[model samples]
Target: MTNNNNISLLTAILFFSILIPLFLSSPPSSSTVSTKTLVLPLKIQKPPIGFLSTSKASNSSNNKLSFRHNVTLTVSLTVGSPPQSVTMVLDTGSELSWLHCKKSPTLNSIYTPLSSSSYTSIPCSSPVCRTRTRDLPIPASCDSRKLCHVSVSYADASSLVGNLAYETFRIGSLTRPGTIFGCMDSGFSSNSDEDAKTTGLIGMNRGSLSFVTQMGFSKFSYCISGQDSSGVLLFGDEKFSWLGPLNYTPFVKISRPLPYFDRVAYSVQLEGIKVAGKLLPIPRSSFVPDHTGAGQTMVDSGTQFTFLLGPVYSALKTEFVRQTRGLATVFEDANFVFQGAMDLCYRVPPNRKGFSDFPAVSLVFTGAEMSVSGDRLLYRVQGMTGKGGDWVYCFTFGNSDLLGIEAFVIGHHHQQNVWMEFDLAKSRVGFAEVRCDLVSQRLGALGLNT
Candidate 1:
């Protein structure tokens, strides 16, 4: 069955909580960095049950489980000497990019560092190993074999441990020599392939340790799709012509120290949300920083659904239900239990005309508004009700407070077919509606056939 709950509760909240110093200092100048187009072929990952709603790339029988189609993004990478290609999740909220283990990789191989000629560990006494001033150095003899260690925890109490090390990293045909990363071997994973979604995590936050900063690129972008398992991850300046025009919102930096986590996520002033032509009753503060500068909202690619603060979500849902009450009808019987993360769902008419006739939803950022129409704003949750039920689509918006947190999370579910550009130099995030599958030609991956 399609797991009703996503793969892991932690999967929906890709937010990282780290308590160690990493091997990242100064990022090399973008001028010194060669501009390269690294194609990040995104895979549609299936979330485990109970909390999961996204779709998986697999075509197994479980496809009939939930009609709700929620999906997470992942990409393949070549790590270590002689290059071992491994598929990893592309996480914009995480800071450190790590591998599954220390081994030489095969098609299905674990990363065995002991077998790689290019393997070398950074010492425990290194500056990167020390998280804070006067902190004790990691327990090691200060030698090549003496590696610094780090532990990463998620909101669900699941955790992983790894040692800091440097190895050659390659994407497409582009190779970065001596890239710093974690050589991880163990974690709180239950099944062996349970880690298939994350043999490793490719970090894309603003921290110095992130894959984006380490590569010295001031900008990067990923276009995610709702229907297909394919999309594009672009790096450096996008001077391409095929991708059409863009809209932008300045990145917000109202500083508020999170309890035990660094403020490394990409935040924006989410002024308000609009349903149909009317604005929701929630205050802008519901999604913005307070006097303490905490609670500013961010958009994450790894998270599968859009999350709002509890009260803000209530206002949004109230307005949505008010506007879309008669647009589509579904079987809301005793057999139809609300198990998916998205609270608002409907059975699209067999003609599918109900979607086009439905009310619209839009998010007003400080500089621009992201207007989502019909099907794009909702997920077509397939079989959450059995084959006997009448349901076609489910809305993807939900309250994050229900999950015990309150950060406005704009996940991939809402970003489908949206071209998002993260320009660090301009300090803005640009969004536009485009078919993600067309991105290959937009990047000229297929040669100018259009």
Candidate 2:
């Protein structure tokens, strides 16, 4: 979905879903026998270009989102004693799950402070509040009255601010006690439609207080099919016999002490990229961790478009242009020149039809491999440069200039139509190609015996 002449500035903020293990304290040993795996169906959506969004159809009051929002997925589950189902974004890039605090008495399914007997506040001086770990290094501080205060900011200045507290969270048949979360009383809305849609964010990173950590698990995995179908996100004990011939690669740990690395993300080694079976000229070192200790490749559920450091993007674009010699050069605006964080969009002429011959793009991971077909490599659009314009497909991959510094990001666009598993026990990342919508025979569910 490309933007019209007046491109929308709505950008998908980095939700940094990192699942690092605990080093500050001895993490509770994951109970293998009794650790019940929970299965939650995720509703995924591809909201326009250069943005992110998704919510239940019933959440229409204030959840007006732009036509061009980013690719975001939401999971609906209840919380508190009576179990009020609330929809929150399933972000691997975030640390703690949170909810928008209710101000009015009649707000739909929001968290009411006066209600819920399981609610417990984390004091500013409490041990949980003072712990400085990755993703949550700035551990929540206390306000003047000694209330545990938490504030989170997203990529486009959108934010969530409130008190830190714990409540009973019930998703599917699984229930968790003392689930850590922020009572979001205030925050920024990218647009009007997003005001009420800002129900909350569910964090599943590696922080001690993250959903996975609180649940006492070392591993989890999600198979994303795409926008049309609901996918499975399983926590604990995922045996991928359904995805035949699983290729596993070491899930390297980049130390957090370095200021350059976010430390909250799961990092992987990228050897290089190939287009049409030909390797790009980009040096392998460019994809690896640089001297500053940054630029390692990562896979994230929150990011919509795959981003490459400047060096990789330049080389890839050059090779791509060289391969597709006859394709239309997608021009934007009156200048018809490419600049900014995103460019390289071309439209087919009136007489001509769909993309004729596009080359395939592949990522060469350390040990694993992902073959990206040409269709997934570009964004097909009907109108963009002008009204009722010819259909075009924008270059879905982007470079460092648009993202500020050269940053390596493997967004969900590349993750589609594949089976991916993040195994924390062996510290490895595994992948296989398969149909995501097919119902898989379960190895485990929350209450059912495997």
Give the number of colliding residue pairs in candidate 2.
18
Instruction: Please give, for residues 1-450, the per-residue lDDT of candidate 2 as tens digits.
Output: 100001111123333322221222222222232367667776675434523223311123342222223446667778876776688777765566788876633234477756777777666666556664333534466788697777665444455578777777777666676677778787664443433553676776555566776767688777777545566677677554566887877765764455445454556788889999998888767877766556766666666677677778888888887887776654444323222344566665656543436888888988877877745777654223333555445677776455354346677667776777777668777778776677332433222333
Best by lDDT: 1
Clashes of each: 29, 18
The digit string of per-residue lDDT tens for model 1 on 90-203 reads 777566677778442222446778766676676676676654212111221233457677666554344567777777677765666666777776676422333544557777
CA lDDT of each candidate?
0.61, 0.60
**Runs in model 1 with CA error above 4 Å?**
1-21, 25-32, 37-40, 46-70, 102-109, 131-146, 190-194, 255-262, 291-293, 330-341, 347-354, 380-383, 386-388, 444-450
